[model samples]
Target: MNRVTAWLPDRIDRRVRVVAWLSFLAQTIIIATGGAVRLTGSGLGCPTWPLCTEGSLVTTPEMGIHGMIEFGNRLMTGVVGIVAVLVVLSIWRIRRERRDLWTLAVVVVLGIVAQAIVGGITVWTGLNPFIVGFHYVASLVLVCVTAAYLVRLDAVPGPRELAVPSWYAGLTHATTAVLAVSIVFGVLTTASGPHSGDADAGRTGYNAELLEHVHAWPGYALFVLTLVLLVGASRLRLPVRRWVVVLLLVEVVQIAVGLYQARNGLPPLAVGVHMVLAALTAATMTVLVLKLKRPTATAAPAGDAAVAASAR
Candidate 1:
């Protein structure tokens, strides 16, 4: 065990950074592939949980393209699991010294397992819209955690202090709240729209049009707030400046795709892009939140993160 521990790096190295990035990238890829499964109407292509179908561990020739798409997404989960495991092992030696990285790695693994079960439930429940929405929210959360790990990877091992003004921090947090609200409403909007994973899966019995407008309200609010943040960040030269800019750009593309899909008969391709962008938006926001604080290098007390600016 000592030899094994010795083999692991005591600090973040290229390998550690690679694995950290892979963890986040894999999470994002899975979301995109999951979007493919839904947009392609293959949510039930497997037709059962823990198995592709009765007495078969994979999709059969008889299942056709839908099965392949759904099964492909499932296979991607295995890829995600493998990457997550690598993350845990890669940081095993440093777990004691870097509890934040260790904890986030464990969370990624647990989140993947939870996602698999929730995915099965989506199948069992006939793709219940609410459950599906929750599943999506759960995945976004995993993306956020992985993104946070990447941020914390470079943090100094000590307590943190807000680098921005108190009011700026409060506005930043409120923007995060608006972002969450936007996502919730967007999920609801999709739940009642034409795309519910499967044709026969039906919808959440709400007004799709109304929910679209409701979703846009928060989206617009988030955009305005982010604009304000970007202006302040540019002037203050805050650490979070670049990432808030990223968040704003993502929102722009997201809103564009959303509008295009809404007006263009809800094209599956556009919808899939929108979904992936949403995950990216959430991930970017996670980075922004982490940047609100800087490591107090000389603090008597310990903390979770370190100097993360260059790591991004």
Candidate 2:
């Protein structure tokens, strides 16, 4: 144990920060690649789970562009998995001293495994719209978790200070709820729209136009709530004002993308950009929520702190 501790960094510093950012970027990149799979109608390129095909483990010359695209996206998952493992291993020595970071790192590794299973199920179900929607939501949830981990890293080795009022915390919670609803409705809209990943893929069988309007309502509510939150944060001189502004800007850009896509017939490029922004918005909201509350202290038993201090 002493040797392991000596091998790893004793403190959370530049190396840890770089790994955290890499983990976040890996998640973001996979979202974009996943979007490519759907936008290009390549969801079933491999046509088999745990393998590219019945006898092949990767794309072949006969599989065509669709096959290659889907297989490529699958390969990207390996990259994410590698990063997840690195993040977990990097924090092993400090696990007792910083359980929050260690726990999140482990969660990220497990989440990637679960995501792989979900991806396989999506393929087995023949690209069911509901299943695919759930898969996207799972990615967003992972993004939120990773973002929280990143923000919390900055407050380590000390007691966290509360940065916002009780009411502001409640407001942040409300904003998160509304944002979740909007994302669900947005997924529903896509499920009912023309993008079914493949020509034979099943859709939700609802009126796309109606779903679009429903999604827009929550988005509008989120916009108003964020605007109010921004004003309140500014008036109260909370540290989260910058994050609020960022969230508002992301919301405006997403709204514009949705409107333009609706008018322009849901072009692949527009939808792709919208998907990226959605991930960004989720990350921003996560950081904002984490920043509003006090940082969690390492809950050591009676003599653990003294032991840790001596070890350092």
Top TM-score prediction, candidate number: 1
TM-score of each: 0.94, 0.92
Q: Which pairs clash in model 2?
A: none
Clashes of each: 5, 0
lDDT by residue (tens digit), candidate 2, 32-145: 999999999998988999899999999988889999999999999999999888787777777787788898998988999999999999999999999999989888888888
Angstrom error of the Cα, residue 104, model 1: value is: 0.7
RMSD of candidate 1 to the true fold? 2.9
Question: Which parts of model 1 have CA positions greater than 4 angstroms off?
Answer: 1-6, 300-312
lDDT of 1 by residue, 192-271 (tens): 99888898997989999999899999999999999999999999988889988899999999999988998998999998
In candidate 1, list every pair of residues with a backbone clash. Answer: 155-305, 155-306, 155-307, 156-306, 156-307
Query: Model 2 scores what on Cα lDDT?
Result: 0.87
What's the CA error at residue 92 for candidate 1, in Å? 0.3
lDDT of 2 at 149: 86
